[model samples]
Target: MGEKDKAYVEIYDTTLRDGTQAEDVNLSVEDKIQVALKLDELGIDYIEGGWPGSNPKDVQFFREIRNYHLGWAKIAAFGSTHMAKYRAEEDPNLRALIEAQTPVITIFGKTWDVHVRDALRITLERNLELIRDSLAYLRPHAERLFYDAEHFFDGFKANSDYALATLKKAIEGGADCLVLCDTNGGTLPQEIAEIIKEVRSRLGKDISLGIHAHNDSDTAVANSLMAVSVGARHVQGTINGFGERCGNANLCSIIPGLVLKMGFKCKAGEPERLRRLTEVSRFVFEIANLPHNKYLPYVGRSAFAHKGGVHVSAVSRNPETYEHIRPELVGNSQRILISDLAGKSNVLYKARQFGISLSAEDPVVKEIVVRLKERENEGYQYEAAEASFELLMRRIVEGRKETFGFFDLISFRVLDVKRLEDERSLVEATVRLKVRGEEEHTAAVGNGPVNALDNAVRKALLAFYPELADMELEDYKVRVLAGEPGTAAKVRVLIQSKDGEDRWGTVGVSHDIIEASWQALVDAIIYKLLKSRRKRLEAA
Candidate 1:
């Protein structure tokens, strides 16, 4: 499409407000401020901070945000239309919106007749007045006023005339944009497209339209995209599809879709910035304390992961054969999962990923392949434990191996004792280490054997490397190998460790659970120390 014919869609992020509605998703005022800054950095057009009338946290959020400078995003304060019992000027919600002092104010009002009568217990005419008065009152205070027609799709389906009447009232009240909301999230893409087409025809070509969709039907992203395809110029979504019920539309997926697939320009439309979609998506997930959904589209870990032999072989020859879009387009890399179904090409590709100089014809490559298969058979999954696999590959490839010795471990002992008199069990660990030919012995007690072991090791090494204090174990997971002796199954342990700047995962497998955990813990500490040493050397 030519520049003259190009469509520009404004991307509005509601992660702090709508996203917090998702179960188990909560953000502090500081968190809200951080996310708003990140959205601004990502070139988002608008950020709906929160509803100031709903809670004191949101009110404080508005106050806190006044201190920061948002380069591109206009912060929006969200609320509902005036209550039926109060005048727009007297409404607490409207007063709170004004207090927020944002450039944009968005207020959602009931458009469905059922919601108007059943929820609000007000006449249809009264609801229309509420919509009009609320926007009219805020019109002078805000640079842009948006009226979200709540339950719009269902309202239009049930009573098209009433829904259109509500929109007309909002327009007459001087709303800058009319947002059509799939509040129930049950509308399909085809239905949304047709309804939007009808709305555009009735509302006229000059009227700006926005879409707000939920994911209860698992089509929120699809519905939003469909609305844009039809004529909606503004798209409202939360980061990672977070909201009440299923979620709102996912901006991570929608941004790339609108820009790359639909030829629309959004703030995130620039190719270079758009490539950071994965980083941004993961950052939001991290802030939410939610695990990243590996199966998510565009920015997921497994989006470009190939597991099957034929798929890996073909992707190796030409990524275009199995991949739809280039992985680099979204700042994600192609991952070749090693499994029983993997071929020699998978091993070769993996070797290259580690920067190990090995050829398809090299005997060591075959050796590595056999080693992977044999270890996998014994319950080692390199795909989920890439750190262990990388160390293994380094160990197998002679002369290319890196040294793992930062400190030498002399011995360790763990003691677990339960006393009837105490009514509580006790665990203690002692670790002996040698650094620069000097030996240090340290002992510590902890809630569990692993904790004691971690304490003892760190206690012994803290003098030699004080920065180790910054590194702590974040997560520890244990999975027993399936089809093995149930009670005697060999357990695989994965430990994730993080310093202030970076996180790394290490793995170990053994029949003894404690031993496996110890191996992983040791590897975690080693990885951290090695990384720190490298940074120091680079600085020097």
Candidate 2:
């Protein structure tokens, strides 16, 4: 079937408005504009900029975003109904929505009687009038005006007649679409389906309907899908599910659920745009300065990572055996994790990934698996340290006995000098290594023992390998393993290194923290040297 022939649903993203309400999620005006541009590239139907009346940052965003042209999305300004003390036309909040000059305007109003009585502290009749007046005042200025019936599900349950009455007021006020919001996020999928059905029955199918859900109950995605099944044509959510409390519906999960699983269509569901989903998801997290949630469905690093031997074996033959859909469809790739759970199949699969062809029956593969499990039992984690694992496999495959062929560690020492009169401690490290069978000795001083050791080692290797100049230590992490040793427990060190073009991870474990760090650091240097040599060979 053609794209035009499928049932179409509108994807309205409020990441800038509602998503920023999340704790620890704060975006500048420029960040908001960049996110809107990204959403436009993803083919979103509407991008809620923010409440211009609420903050100067949002107002600045609405101004700056006007300078750029969006390919697909229409900009929306979000706000609440005007206060009861002022007429809608005379209200500053309503005026700000009009002044934003956006093609779309969304205003939310109290739907639950409890909110009207307790929150708004206004009569139910007055709240209804505010909903009607605010939307009506902004209707002509906006190309599209959407009404959000806040707490609609709870409102319907509290007073079905009043909740249904709120919809009537919005319709009378010239709303282009009425979005039913599960504000408290306590509604279930079954409840969403039943409530939407009842709304459709009473309000008829002529009026446009949308669903806005929160994830307090962890059912925002499911509730959004359920609302779609019950005739909601518009779906509202935020990227990565960011919001005030638990979060709004996650567009990352909802988009694929609607298109791939349910056979519905939207602009983002198009093949080309869908492939950018993972990139877009990571980009937002980067801009937010937050760590990406690796377990997020469809767009996470661990989403399709196979760890179990049996599962990896099955998926190697056919991805459908383990994956619900092809990872490439969402621009993500399958991953094979190596650990104690790894089998011969896992070893062969990883070898292939590293461009080393190996058969399932290879004795070297069996040896590698055995050694890997033994290392893991000793607190070594290869899942995040693939470079170290690859080096181990190469050594086993080649039948080499030395720890590393590039260099050999003879001995190293660190000393700290402190005085009672001085508040700071001076640290120094000395390293001796044989590079190409030639012994090289170096010494260096640094802020700490690890830094001094790293500097000394690099100084020692720089004379033999000029390419080591470009290599940098990106991140270092240490974890103490649980054991009966108390403060003397074994520690694992994971080091991340990058050489401008490529990055790799290596790990080492020992009872001494410095020794563990040195082991990882040595693995990192060896990996870099080997990678540079491979590239040079390939070029030749």
Tens-digit lDDT string for candidate 2 (179-220):
999999999999999999999999998789999999999999
TM-score of model 2 vs. true structure: 0.65
Top TM-score prediction, candidate number: 1
lDDT of 2 at 149: 96
For the record, the alpha-carbon RMSD of candidate 1 to the native fold, in angstroms, is 6.3
Give the poorly placed runs of model 1, Cα more than 4 Å off.
Answer: 2-5, 339-540
TM-score on alpha carbons, each prediction: 0.69, 0.65
Model 2 has an lDDT value of 0.88
Model 2 ranges off by over 4 Å: 1-5, 339-540
lDDT, candidate 1, residue 327?
Answer: 75
lDDT of 2 at 309: 90
Model 1 agreement with the true structure over 70-133: per-residue lDDT tens digits: 7888999999999888999999999999999999999999989999989999999999999999
Least accurate 10 contiguous residues by lDDT in model 1: 339-348
RMSD of 2: 8.1
At residue 335, what lDDT does model 1 achieve?
Answer: 75
